[model samples]
Target: MTTMIKTVDVTTALSDVDRFCDIPNARISGEIFHRQDIYEQELEKVFARCWLFVAHESQFKKAGDYIATTMGEDDVIVVRQKDGSHRAFINACPHRGNKVCFSESGNARGFICNYHGWSFDIAGNLIGQHESGIYENSHFDASKWGLREVALIDSYKGLLFANFDADAPSLKEYLGPMAWYFDALFDNQEGGTEFVGGCIRSTMDCNWKIAAENFVGDILHAGWTHDSAARAMLGGAVAKVSDFDESYSVNWHGHGYEFAMDTVGNVAVLGESALNKYLHTIKPSVAERLGDFRSNMIGSVSSATIFPNFSFLPGQNTIRVWQPRGPNKIELYTWVLVNKSAPEEIKEKWRKGAMMTFSPTGVFEMDDGENWEYCTKTARGKVTAKQDLYVGLGQESLLQETDLPANVYSGQLNEANSRAFYQFWSDLLKAPSWNDVPNRNVGRVEAGAAAERCSLKEAK
Candidate 1:
């Protein structure tokens, strides 16, 4: 039974997308977090068109190793091919849309549908089907019945990303200015980085943007929101605000990074003496390789997000993807990363330290989960949903003397990156195609003009 639907004008729909976010004034309407219609459109515009983090290269050591993951609402299977490269595909069987891969992860030669016995090889080819000889139509081409492959798959350093839009820019180009900053975390050492422990999965009763916006540029919440956890982890002092604090909040193409110049602030929070010691020992070398700005960021009290939903902590080394479950829920997938050249003991310490601090039962995670839940739950109120949330912390604070790329602003407390994030998000929601989306980062920062606008010292 096919149902025909009449088309309605979406001009108003497109026009209203930017209304939820007032970037100039740094006010975000609560409705964007809870609206069903906007959430549905996000699936098509943001997740479907962006390069989303899917897996890590270390997860697949041998041929045929695979993991079942999600790209927005769609189930995807990322596989390690025999050629030492990677490939990903939609995890649904073409026969009747049944899921083809059941396990979360494992090494398998191929995927077989539990229903109808249709099977696909590791390369996503239709290799077998149940007893196909009887009354096979000439039109039934086995070659055409294969599982659908993802449009593109690529990696940055060791982290893998997949894109569903063939028209989308390549991962490197899409990463843009953010890629330069990524080197501060991923390229600090020569041996490169690898995921140590397997992924830890949990669910949060919060809008996906809520969690992402936190990592994007919400260090202000750290001092107050996680005060107890910080005390437990770092002994007496929490992430307190000081008049002389030197840090930066930066964003480009929607990606955000906020950090303190104090190199061991976050590393000390891990409560691992050896790990903290290790960072101090390597700080000089990292500085030589990546420069002072990036090297100082290596283990600083920093939080960053790569556009839509990929986030990580530099010193704590916890990488996460906030996979959207619905408008008001997100499935959080987390992993611990360490440099391959680091000592084995350090790797083990990081694995356990991250587990204690950021995992499901982690002290920090518990506090964050509860808060984001309340944030989402309260927004459902008719009156509350109409309220506007302020994100104008550092609206008057732009930096120019710094060598950091893209929109550089003052301190760990600023909401500049958060505002930029919402602006890009709104742009994506409204743009009809990639061509329509504007590159706001171009000419965003002119050193001489920015330096005269506001000094970091005066802003603080």
Candidate 2:
């Protein structure tokens, strides 16, 4: 039996998401980018169920250190406790729904609500309130009035993530094979990675998915869209995509990455010679530890998105999350990441270099913002919203003769990753519960295992 879920759309009234997605044909409707009702459903079905990036362990060195961030539109405060464990809670006060914390981050003994003076301990337990004698006659119990705690929280390689859905899989399980690729960037260094400075936030008049899907695998846009910026920084355009013999666009489940074998192409875009030289000096040791496959990727021309909205540029070392502000707008939060073992000078170079190319006011960022904003703004028309946008550029280019995990397409210019991303998006939107959502990568993983076993037997 097939379960058909109807999703709301501005153009078609109520319709199945499959009609809009059209995975086999590689087409999708524009209404998915600008519909208010669809965006509301995504909040409940996608944002609330995913393992969203919240904060990094480097941000909290001692008890009570905390940073206030968002998972979807719901404001949350992730705090370190006395026991050295981390926890997160809703940023709103239990009394009258007032915001408790105003600062972005700080070390505090407790959070006090300005509206009614209700106070909560670092662990989210209600400890005090204004005029205790006044509440003595009421049914208010301090023990039961604590701030609502986030359902689940976990970490991977110093990055902390929180989940609102208790029924969702553990973070490790949720990451699945994507963890294999992440280990190269995050865990390859001896001392691991850390954020360099306070986050820089900016707003864009575009849907979050437009920004996300770009990072996911739209390498085709780089050569044309950012050509001027690339020429300014690197003294030439980004790598030519028509000759993609050594490049791939790979997707695992919903996560996607596109990269080329030009080991220093992305680093060169930062226009910092010291940083580029630094990567070369460390490549041999990385190869010894994680093997050539991941080691060669250390300073490669690559970009990735971890489903829904988090994205990063590997060699440029810019990490960001696109928090959906509304159906047609997003708030982008960005940070520069560097290896903790790096020298002070090298880390400083990384901070400035990344900002020069990817920050809100950077040359590359300016080009992207205009493109995505127009992509969202023009989709608002009734006739324009009904048209299907073509995403089927390289449907016939699937590559299987490789050890790469997940779905690997042969060229950097392919839309395979974008197609895989939308398929997963539709799957999430149409499923009633997590149980109904399918793991689309299972067969690819199994087939890879089978191929590996065959080669091993032949070697004997």
Provide the overall lDDT of each model, using Cα atoms, as 2-decimal numbers: 0.84, 0.83
Question: On residues 61-111, what C-alpha lDDT tens digit does candidate 1 reach at each position?
Answer: 899999899998999999998999998888998889999999999999999
Q: What are the per-model C-alpha RMSD values against the true structure?
A: 5.3, 5.1
lDDT per residue (tens digit) for residues 245-296 in model 2: 5888888767888888766778888898998898888887776666666777
lDDT accuracy of residue 317 in candidate 2: 88
After best superposition, candidate 1 residue 195: deviation in angstroms? 0.8
Clashes of each: 0, 0
**Alpha-carbon error at 162 in model 2, in Å?**
0.8
Give lDDT for model 2.
Answer: 0.83
What's the TM for model 1?
A: 0.93
Candidate 2's C-alpha runs over 4 A off are 1-15, 446-460
